[model samples]
Target chain A: MRAVAVGQAELKLFWRNRTALFNSLLMPLLLVPVLIAVDASGVPLVIGLVGFALLMAVYYNLVTTFVARREELVLKRLRVGELTDPEILVGAALPSVVIALGQMVLYCLVVAVVTGVDLPSRPWFLLLGVLGGVAIFVLLAAASSAFTRTVEMAQVTSLPILMACLFGSGMMFPLTNLPEVLAKVLQYLPLTPVLQLLNAAWADGPVIKPLTVVAVWIVLGTYAVQKWFRWDPRR
Target chain B: MTAIEVRGLTRRYSGGFEAVRGVSFEVERGEMFALLGTNGAGKTSTVEVVEGLSRPAEGTVRVLGHDPFAERAQVRPRMGVMLQEGGFPPDLTAFEAARMWAGTLTSPRPVDEALEMVDLTHRATVRVKQLSGGERRRLDLALALLGKPEVLFLDEPTTGLDPESRRNTWELIRALLREGVTVLLTTHYLEEAQALADRLAIMHRGRIVAQGTVSEVVDAYPSRISFVPPAGVTLPFVVDAEPSGRVTLRTNSLQSSLHELLAWAHLNNVELSGLDARSASLEEAFLAIAEEAA
Candidate 1:
């Protein structure tokens, strides 16, 4: 209940900053046009764009958010209240999670309309993948923030993961386009299974293997967050 | 009931720096206890331990009969803390931030009332980054008071406040004190300590050099009486007799010193001009302690 209140506040603040809102809310939407320009059909491109939005929502947005709040002592102040460490972290991530999910829905609708493609054959797979991606990336963002010493340093520390997911996770390009050996290896990166799950939902492909891969990443991400998440800023 | 107790509290950082060394004190319910110290005097460290923000290396700390660190849930809800620096979200409006903070506590006072308590109702919609330093301090106070906490910890609560705002904060704290709220405040302003603290402790070099009522600490230092005697009149009770017809007297008792000087003037039909007798003030005692520590 308290986490919901905190999340609401975070969401309000998230929108109030026009620059942040532009980056988090509108940046991915801007990418949709670029993807369409590159791929005239744009169906697979739209799916990749949605995955890219999820990456920003949980990884880029949340890493900087946690780092900025910690540097400002906001996280330390919240810890003094009834909220536990995990409560504060999860609550802080809630705003970005919601925004990312909303963006994904909007993207799917736009893709369906633009490409004249039908809706997903299985909606449950897509829903599970989206939520599971949010969960895993939220934890990874927090775990990444522990090593981020300052708000300025967040930009530097968050870049490697951003590049890795964009290039390796089928965000900017489809995994099928890669060499057989490269695709096999990239398939195990943190965000690969989520994107694969989304593709499976759209194309009526197998779900269990991708689902298992996402579950494993979720466990590893949760463990990383629990082990290294710093409630206070690095001193 | 004792609201806070620290016994043999010692806090050492990783680099062999002992911020607090065997410091102990208690704050009673309905009382205001100030902790005064110079920079690096361990005042904030001691307060942090009491607030359960940090643990003591070797000692016991209890707030309302519960170990603050071991039983944080029981003690934290009942206490309010104003950190040395305001930690509010910069993008949040003052009103929005206060409302959100209030929601984190149990049965918090109305957000509007808390803002009004700190005289911040007028700046309700202003973002925290736009607020002046004094306004930000008030915002910190507003959040601290939102919970209507039983014990309040204010670390230099009025550092950046102007004179009027400082007095207003003091009034707010006094009103809470009247309602039996225990306050443990650290301040560089000696006058603030003198005005608000029922009892205080002066810490130096991680140790408390003095702890008592304001008057008791002040009285530990000698008072001074200086006067220019009438021509050809012998000085009485003179601690120092200057050759320029000026006499300086030192005594622990100010009242008797004044009385004897007046009697001496009357007996000789001579006037004692420029008579100035003053007991030590808290500021004086504070400086004396600091000087001794140096």
Candidate 2:
């Protein structure tokens, strides 16, 4: 209940800043069309775009927000309350996760209509991918924030995962089109399994490997958060 | 009942610097206890331990009969903390921030009431980033008050405020004190300590150098009685007589020194002009201690 209140307040604050609102909404809205234009098909493009949106909204956005809040002492103030450590992190991440999920659904509908792609054959697989992706990215954001000292440093620290996901997660190009060795390597990146699961759901392909890889990422991400998460600003 | 108790509290940083070294003090219920100190004097470190934000390297801290660190859940709900620096998110308006803070507590006062108490109702809609420094301090105060806490910790609450705003804050704190709130505050402003603190401890170099009521602390130093006696009148109790026809006397008891000088003047039918008698001020005492520590 307290987490919901904190999340609502965080959402209000996020939307009030017009620049942040524009960036969060516009990037996904514009990126989906660009991906469709490049691929000339909607299914794979929509999946990649959904993954991309999750990365921006859940991972990058939250990493910066957590860093900024910690530097500003907002996290410290919240810690003084009855709110537990997990409650504070999960609560702050709630708004971004909701935004990403909403954007994913909106993009899927738009892409399906524009490119005449059929609905997913296995919607449950897509749901698993989206939910798992959001959870993984949120945990990664908290883990990343542990190392970020300031908002400026957040920008630099977020780049590696972001760039890795952009290329290796099959957002820009399909993993199958790459060399065999490269495809195998890129498939192990954090967002790869999520994107593959989403694409498989769209195309009715096999889901076993992608599901297993995503579950592995979730476990790894959870462990990272537990090990490295910092609630206070570095002195 | 004691509101706060610290025994041999010490905090040492990783780089071999000890910020607080075996400092101890107690604040009784309904009392205003101030911690006055210079920069890096361990006032903040001590308060942070008492607030349960940090653990003491050694010793114990109890707030309202519970160990603040080991038993924060029992104490935090009834305690309020106002840090010396940024704690509010800069993007939120004052009303939104206060409302959010109110949501965290069990039985918070109304957000509007808290805002009005800090004289921030007019700025309630203003973003924290846009508010002036004094307004920001007021917002911090409002959040601390939102929980309706019984024990309040204010760290330099009026540091950024102008004279008028500072006095307004003092008035609000005084009102809370009247309602039996236990306040523990740290400040570099000696006047503020003297004005609000029922009893205070002055810390220097990680230890308290003076602790008592304002008058008691000031009384530990000598009082001065300076005057120029009439011509041909040798005044008693004159410790120093300069060639410029000025006589100055240092006394532990200003009243007795004044009486002896007046009696001597009356007996000789001579008048003493330009008489001045006053004990040391808190500022003087603080400066003396700080210099001694240095």
Candidate 3:
């Protein structure tokens, strides 16, 4: 119940900032027209767009959010109340998660209408992929904030994961197109299984491997958050 | 009953700097205890531990009979903390921030009442970034009071307020004390401590140099009597003469010393120009401790 209040406040703040609103809600849509203009296939395009939305709306956005709140001492002040550390984090990440989920639905509808692609044949996989992706990315963003000293530094510190997800996680291009050895290694990247699960929802593909991968990443992400996530700014 | 207790509480930074060293004090219910100190004397560090913001490196602290750090869930709802800096999101209006804070408490007062307590109701719509420094401090107090906490921890709560606002805050705090709220305050302004704290501890270099009622602490230091020495007239007692021809005397018994000087002057028919006799103030005791530590 308290987490919901914190989320409501965070959502209000999210709306007041025009830049964040644009980045979370509008930036992902900008890629939609481009993919459509290029006449990309339905399944791959939807998968790539989902990956991009999760990356921007959850990961990068939360990195800045955590860093800024820490530096501003908002996290410290909130801790003085009844809110636990986990409650504070989950609450802060609520708005971004909601936005990402909303974006995924909007993207699916747009792709389905324009490209004449069928909606998800297995909607459960899509739901799992979206929910799992949000959780992992939120954890990853918080862990990244440990090294991020300032909101401005988030741009620099968040680059490596952003690049890995873009090029190595099969978000931009399918890992199957690369050598088998490279594809096998790239499948372990955080975003790969998420894209795979999204693909599994729309087309007939192996679900167990991607599901296990998603579960493993969630575990790893949770561990990383436990080990390194900092609630207070460095003195 | 004791509302807060600390024994040999020590806090160390990551770099091994001991900010608070074996500090101990007790605050009774319905009483105010001020922690007064020089800059970097660990007043804030000590208060943070009691607020359950951090754990002590050594010793133990209890708030209302529970270890604050370990039993935070039980104690937090009953205590309010106004940090040195509010650190509220700059984008939030004063009212929005109060309402948001109120949401976290189990039972909170009306947001408008909290704001009005700090005289911040008029500024409720202004963004925090646009508020003045004093206004921000008041907002911090408002949020702290939202839960109607039993124990209040104020770390320099009025640091940036104007004189009028500071007085208003004091009145508000006094009202809380009347209603049986326990207050633990830290402040650089000694007069604030003198005015508000029923008892206080003066800390220097991470240690409490003096702990007592305001007069008790002030009494430890000597009172002063100063005036220009009458030309070519010997004084009744020894005096330290300044270069400007003014002589001064420090004494524990201010009344006796002043009476003696007046008697000697009357007998000699010599005028003691610029005569002034005053007891030591908290500022004097505070500065003396700082100087002794140095």
Best candidate per lDDT, number? 3
- Candidate 2 local Cα displacement, residue B153, angstroms: 0.7
Q: Encode model 2's per-residue lDDT on B124-144: one tens digit a residue.
A: 989888999999999989988
* Each model's chain A TM-score: 0.93, 0.95, 0.95
Model 2 regions lying over 4 Å from their true place: A37-40, A149-153, A200-216, A219-235, B227-248, B263-273
Better of 1 and 2 by lDDT: 2
- lDDT per residue for candidate 3 within B194-275, as digits (tens), equals 9999999999889998999999999999999899976798877777789888988999999987898889888889898898
Model 2: chain B TM-score relative to the native chain B: 0.90
Better of 1 and 2 by TM-score: 2
Worst 10 residues of 2 chain A by lDDT: A32-41
- Each candidate structure's TM-score, on Cα atoms with residue i matched to residue i, is 0.89, 0.90, 0.97
| Top DockQ prediction, candidate number | 3
Measured with DockQ on alpha carbons, how good is candidate 3?
0.78
Error (Å) of candidate 1 at residue B42 is 1.3
What local lDDT does model 3 show for residue B289? 83
**Fraction of the native A-B contacts that model 2 recovers:** 0.65
